[model samples]
Target: MYVSARERKLLERLLADDRDITVGELAEELNVSARTVHRDLQGLESVFRRYGLKLAKRAGVGIRLVGEEENKQALAAELFRLSHHEYTPEERQLMILIALLEANEPVKLVTLAHDLNVTVATVSLDLDKLEQTVEAYGLSLIRKRGYGVELAGSESAKRRLMSDLLFRHVDEHEFLALMKETIQKRADAPLDTVAEKLLGLVDRKKLAIIEQQIEQVKEKLPFTMADSSYIAFVVHLALAMERIKRGEAIHFDPRDLQALQATKEYEIAHELAESLEKVFDVDIPNEEVGYMTMHLMGAKWRNRQGTMMEEPSLTVGMKAQQLIRSVSDKLGVDLSTDRTLYEDLVVHLKPALYRLEHGMGVANPLLDQIKQDYAELFAIVADGARQLFGDIPIPDEEIGYLVLHFAAALMREKKGWRVLVICSSGLGTAKILAMRLKKEIPDIVSLEQASAFEWKGKDVSAYDLVISTVPLPEEYGPHIVVSPMLTEEEARKIREHLERKTSAAKRMEKEPTARRNKPIIDTMKAVRRISETIVHILDGFSLEVVKRRSVHEILTDACRRLERSGVIVDADVVVEELRRRESLGGLGVPGTTLALYHARSFAVLRPSLTMYRLDSPQTVAGMDGEPMEINTVVLLLGPADADEEVLSVLSHVSTLLVKDEQSAATLAYGGEDEVYSLISGHLEQFFDDYWISMKE
Candidate 1:
């Protein structure tokens, strides 16, 4: 099984925890089967054994590597070479400066230029390049006026950059030489003290073993400056470890670490140490702990040897608590809602935290389960953060986890509405109707299947809406309806009835107005004139016109004409919105009608008759199964604020067409006189008791 580079990198990340990882977990992370992971593990084991290491696995447990520290360091170096190519000298120099700037608080541009011996302009350009390069890795370059450039992103991204670029490439012999040089440069007492501290970390046997390995490797290959720098890092790591073991609180000069010219890894390690302390209440001296941890975890590959060791169960309850604390602090939320909630959250976070700590790859099952259980809580968190933070700019992973917590909270609080749908028969047509209704009307709380017989017994009135295959029982009250098919006519009628009922309720709440006679004739004349102007403009174009054009085609043609005439700015944008609306559902009102809305103050109603020759007869789905071949189009235009009035008129016109065949035929072939008469007749009856009587 020859693994690809991506697979190999994934395996390396999995092994970074330097502990046991299950085949199932690996398979889940890689989106593959357990058998495939097992095969990959077997191949890795063979490679390990060939390098004088063993791949050990326990049944019901997972796989891991075991070897001496020095050999592990060597293996880490080799693996680093294989996994990541070294940066060019210029890239390395820029990375070094970036690391320094990030590590220090408020590093000034002038100060950085002075340190790097480069022009300020060059520094600026480098910062710009760095900003662009870091984005893909989920990191950002933060430029604060007067504070200089700093790296901002996740702890994981910081660790990866440090480990891949700085620590892994250092040769053992050169690392030792660098350590000796550092000691020599320091005061004798301090140097001796640091050396002793480092020596104390290893016992006599281990010390001899490490020294011999370093000596042998040096003899085999001469040390380079890069190797020496790495040795200095190792010595610092060992010293830090000894101090940690002794429970000594030690702080070294930032300048000393800075002197090694390994600021990138040093700063990363320092940040990691600080995070560990803040999160876990466990402090390690310097960032050396992070560096040493990486080396130890990736050591087998460093030495080109294989050692099989039972994978350690690195799961730590403390670590989970630390993660929870860190996240809460970052979010500025009181996540500790009592001992039990805190404990449960930590338990939920255990697998992910452990994986993060050890560089092991672990799927976030607990987070997923929490999200599944508490969707509303997640929504609230997102909403709350968005309100407070303005954007709540978190990565998807954090969002996903936070959503889970939010949902759980909401479920506990019972904050949102609960809707139940009652529909006749758990069969095909009812299911389709229910689905369509749900999609069309998002305000409905829930949908459930209930037969007419079942509906009588259920609390039908409690539900938001109910659809039935047969007419509901009288006992079910006015809450029920029969609609086996979710046709456009049925949906529109239901929506319109709801709107009218809502309007009537609002009207009842308002105070009575002084009555006055509305000039119905004048308004009708204005509407007709505006309609005529629109028809004239549309007909003026030479583009091919269809008698019964679909709303989408009409809008597209209208937009093209608008752009050609320079009548609209960003016509393409409006066209896109029109197309999108059409995809949702056709925007056409039933009957031989076209409506145009304008935001300007003037109301333009003009009517003109023009014949559109259709290439082929187009069928429009209209009410009453009336297939309309509308050769004559009646275009209506008005101020955008009059949209409500326009909609009401269109609705009334549709009703008239459905009830009166004469009105439809009159408009289809009516000359100017006939068209005017048809519109006036309908408006008189509609306005008489409605608009005119309301004004009076």
Candidate 2:
């Protein structure tokens, strides 16, 4: 059967593992679509059958390669021989563009198709994508009907495309190692051939000369240089020498060249040009020197000998702080104090801002990986970048690097899950179940016990695992159902569920970012799950669309309605407590247009939620000490002596709103019945994470 390299790797990975793997994970590993992987799996089934292996799948458990260990090994060996690897469309497009650039003459589309082993239509599609990729580097794919195609652009733009495409498919370290191996006569590895494919012909002799010249230039510089800068400088200079030897020249913007000539790096570039002229016997143009200066400006600085090698300009530093603060405000987390995050971002921005200014493309091989693994973090950073960079459009590659700093900081956070125990009998029964689980389950960080009465009265969405003693009408598996006595079978089942639910690490497998995020995702999943399941908590809840113009009237009306429904006895008592709480600080969640008015009240016999959608948003003092609008009011009232567990869940709900008004807005803006589902579904994982903190 026909199989791509990615499919081969997927099969090998599946065979080597004893458990199931998700299609999403395989797609990520192969850098393809999930649908693509699904297609590959279908093709793989017949091939696997050849070696007596079968693909077995179950819902939520993912897909597993089921067979004897010997059969798996045999299948792996067979796949190794049969996997005539096909490049992904992205890889093919990049190679095609490079091949086009290398071709001195217009080549036939059929020839290009044959090279890619694809049809003319596929080649055309690939070229369509290639056009955009090249255009970003200021080069155009010029197609001549009945003739062929050529890349039309300035020598400088073509050179930029060359350098970018060189790094796009491979890592910098790998490319460097390839050159070094060639220099040392150790170029026998398969990777050497792959490097050649990526870089075309490197002319190792020219690279060696530029490597020495760059070393000399580095020693003469005042600032500590980054390795990436040094390596890129060598390649750029080598290629420049090659182009000059061919009597070709590159041009830069006159203003940019004029500005570059004033820098120390350009002074060094001039001296280096003189040395290159002597070695390569070609006069290096001043514009090329400006090009080198541009490249130098984009080099990221590195620490040297335990000292900070460089601080970005004062403006860059201020921009960095502003970005960090913006992200902190968005996530509602104190990211500014993350010293490592701040320092690394400052380092990245020094070069990043310069790259943006110079319109240079920085190829980040990990960009796709970062996008998938740290999606939430990436969104926050990307959103913040817009305000700082304006509509300049920071490349996903640059954004990926920026995300790394925050991702690293988030990785430093403690990882685990929280527990919530629900018992229908009473507090004592709840305690029995909670204590047994706590004693047996070390993963239960903090345990809260509540009777079914209290659980229904409050939002129990803040806990990770909700263990119930009596039969729950709700089917919340991963919501362990066990005896209060902690029977051996029940314990085993709980342990198994906890492992599957909490340790997302096993499924993450190989990527560094995924490995780092396993615990974080696990924690979040727990909270999200609780939020999802808490739809029941909103059962018998009151909803209304109030046209009242006064916040006081809105509060009184909600309390009066809850009292009329017999959910709370004294409308006056609930209203007074809510008013008193509001007097301390506005209950309005800034930016959400939703106000949470909640209080522990003597007049409340049970926990109840009343939501009133205002006809229009009203101005109120924001929790952030600014004037903000509020349109949705959520009134929560609990008995004054409500169980601590009930209070805990209610408090978590408040905290959830305070930390992220956007999340609250998501819950508030949905349809009346849907609000309960949205709120419950979103908070499931938060409860899990709450348990984790308790463990701490």
Candidate 3:
């Protein structure tokens, strides 16, 4: 929320240039150290990433924002609107005319006249206005006498003209309204020009009727002003009327009679009927009954005589009752004949009826209350209890019923649910893991696959659960780790975990102290630890050994280890980024070499050594298209943030490896001790660079 002034300036620069910038250049421009520039880039990248943007870097090319075209357009649009007051309406109109002309061929005066429905003389006058406006904006407006006007000017002039004419004149609300109208008009139109297309969707007949209704209402009420809200109310009522005619439930809000006491009686009735239809699925025809109800309420609100303390009676005659009964029968709901039952039903129906009559709100609150009070009666009348069930089951059952119930409850409580599936490798085994987990979890809205390390670094708070096959990072989410075989015991344990979590969540709601509170990540870590402990007991494999293997090797091993481990499974997990990185550069490094190894069960890493040593070391391209040398090699094991973390470390390592001085110093120390220290120091720097690139 609080962007630094420097970041703000950087954003402006990007917006203006529409290109990526290098850290070196930014440092020079900002008159800051390269380190500071790198930090700033990281901060910026973090902010943008939260908004679904990616900051990409090429080893020597610098940083650029990937997938932010739409964001830039939106920002440009906002800037234009803020500067709109500088242009007059006439100038704006002329500018649009010029743009249209420039887009078309031949510059036909007749076509222009026809487009605006104006005479040729008027078109000429508009062209003159356009020329004057263009000149003021530092642009040249050329008239070909025979051809139409064309803008021939500097790019800056063109940009200024476009910014003022297109972006500046349209505010968000106006834009939304225009877009809605355009889309309504041309439903089949491409999405590029939504606002324009919507205008074409409006039905002429419906629009005329709406206008007529509005006029009539104005005469009766006499106090309502014609504002955008009122216009929207009228449009929605018109649309709702059409929907109701087609037996559709109206979804629009109705005008408030109390707020629009000055509107005419007929308009009030129309608005109220629309509101009622939307709220209660009742289609009341335009009848005297509706008019009378509106008259009563309109009169009360107009006189300011109705108190909040007073409850208005909404009793209808036997004829109206019979009509209601007919509707209920049509809807397949039984209607009680007893006077008291009928009276109570009428009480529930009154608000809707009143709204139908007076352009008042017909919200379902009163009906909901009535249903709660006489649920049994209403249930039978509304139709068999089956109506309540539909596709959803009753709340208390186990299996599918409980799942649906939990899903709905969670949706209501959290607004929605997101999930992440953590698994090793990017190919066969990870996919199988995801598929198996998906079968067990029904409420997952989104599922992303990555290794434990990648999942831990990324934000996981949005996910409800993390189901993994291998030991994950020290922290992740509510985890359910299963073996490759996915035995019956594993299934049972998973179910138990879900049940326990569900029960605990319910208990927490009822009694706050029922369970100790812990951060979600901590809980996930505990779950992982527990799952791993059980796995080790069953399989006799140390979790630490599992963790030490690279993601590539983990996947490769999962496939091969399956035959011996009695885990009959096909682990064909292919690390896409690994291959992609190889395509970009190559994963080989000097002295120590990293190669992607594959087997039957899962993908794994196999680090090997080349016996030959180089006398004069030279740079070789690594997985990031960067130069590297033979001293050290880091094989990116799997698709765990391969593009980000792995590639970043490789880039930094390449930088050090390619340096003759650093390599000589490293070689002098010789053993693993010297190599480890050199690599570790560089790793820290690499991490810093990685963070910086991310921010950028």
Give me the candidate number with maximum TM-score: 2
lDDT of each: 0.41, 0.64, 0.40
Tens-digit lDDT string for candidate 2 (610-672)? 688878878886654578887788776666775434544554444434334355666567667
In candidate 1, what are the lDDT values of residues 1-696, reduced to their tens digit? 344443554445553445566777777767779887777666676556555666667888776666654555565555543522233334334444444423635557787667555677877877776766567556787887777777776544553444333333332222333333432332223211112322323222222233333443332221111222233334434344344554544333466434322423334445445543443345665435444434333221111000000001111222223334444555566553322223333333432333344443212223453345445555555454444333224333444544443323222321111233443222223334544565455444434454332355665334434455444346666653434444444566556644554546434422221111124565566455434433343343232345556644665566555546554444556556444433322222244432121112122222112223344544543222334443433322222233433433433333333233465566555565565566656655554434332332
Point out the worst 10-residue segment of candidate 2 by lDDT. 303-312
Per model, how many backbone clashes are there? Answer: 48, 27, 51
Ten consecutive residues with minimal summed lDDT in candidate 1?
304-313
Candidate 2 or 1, higher TM-score: 2
| lDDT value, residue 448 of candidate 2 | 52
Q: Sort by TM-score, best first: what order?
A: 2, 3, 1
Candidate number of the best lDDT: 2
List, residue by residue over 342-398, the lDDT tens digit for candidate 3.
Answer: 332223233334433432322121233334433444443334223422343321111
Off by over 4 Å in 2: 1-20, 24-59, 63-88, 113-125, 171-173, 182-195, 222-227, 304-312, 335-340, 410-696
Q: What overall lDDT, based on C-alpha atoms, would model 1 receive against the true structure?
A: 0.41
Q: Could you tell me the lDDT of residue 98 within candidate 2?
A: 68
After TM-score superposition, the amount by which residue 56's alpha carbon in candidate 3 deviates from its true location, in angstroms, is: 50
